[model samples]
Target: MKETSEKKAIIKKLMKEGKTYKQISEETGIHPGTVGIYGGKLKKAEREKKCFNGDRHLCKTCKYRASGARSGCDYIIHTGNERGCNPEVCNKYERGNRNETKTSSKGK
Candidate 1:
């Protein structure tokens, strides 16, 4: 078995080469969840290295950030009512339609 550091390096290389999480898991025999963690760390390290010269906007403007229209802000209400607003603020704040039916139909 490879050392943890070696495994992490392999995961990073694979990720940089655009390999999917499932592909890395299949090649390294690591669980997909574990590979995801390693991949996240590797990406974070690379991003940090790139932004080392004081660029906080690196993360703030990330495509994965909630500020995008299709991001978490579209569906989640962070300030008004909902509680578990993990990101603290919702960039896409849309008014709720009280008359709209809920998506989930509980009783047939």
Candidate 2:
């Protein structure tokens, strides 16, 4: 109970400090696999939050925007092996439907 929370806190803190799973495991005596699991969860949560909150555009021109992607920017996400144009991928493409909803709601 208390020990579990403590371990989670330690893992999160170490992860925020840019420590790798192996390094965290070595320092905290937690298994590398366990550290990696927690790290993966944290990273997933962070990505979701970033996407939902919107992010800055990485480039002046985005391939996803140019190609008329509606769901969201898939510049790097949909790429199987080919490298994307911008080194940093952005998740802030304004979906047409979502924009319409926003505009309609504002009128009400």
Whole-model Cα lDDT per candidate?
A: 0.59, 0.60
Clashing pairs in 2: none
Segments in model 2 whose C-alpha atoms lie over 4 Å from true places:
53-108
Cand. 1 Cα-lDDT: 0.59
Poorly placed runs, candidate 1 (over 4 Å)? 52-108
lDDT of 2 by residue, 1-108 (tens): 338678888999999999989999999998888888888887877865665332333333444333344543444443443443332344444344322322233645
lDDT of 1 by residue, 1-108 (tens): 778888888898898799999999999898899899988877776765664322343334433334435443223232343434333332333344422313455786
| C-alpha RMSD of each candidate structure in angstroms | 12.0, 10.7
Candidate 1 TM-score, true structure as reference? 0.46
How many Å off is the CA of 51 in candidate 2? 0.5
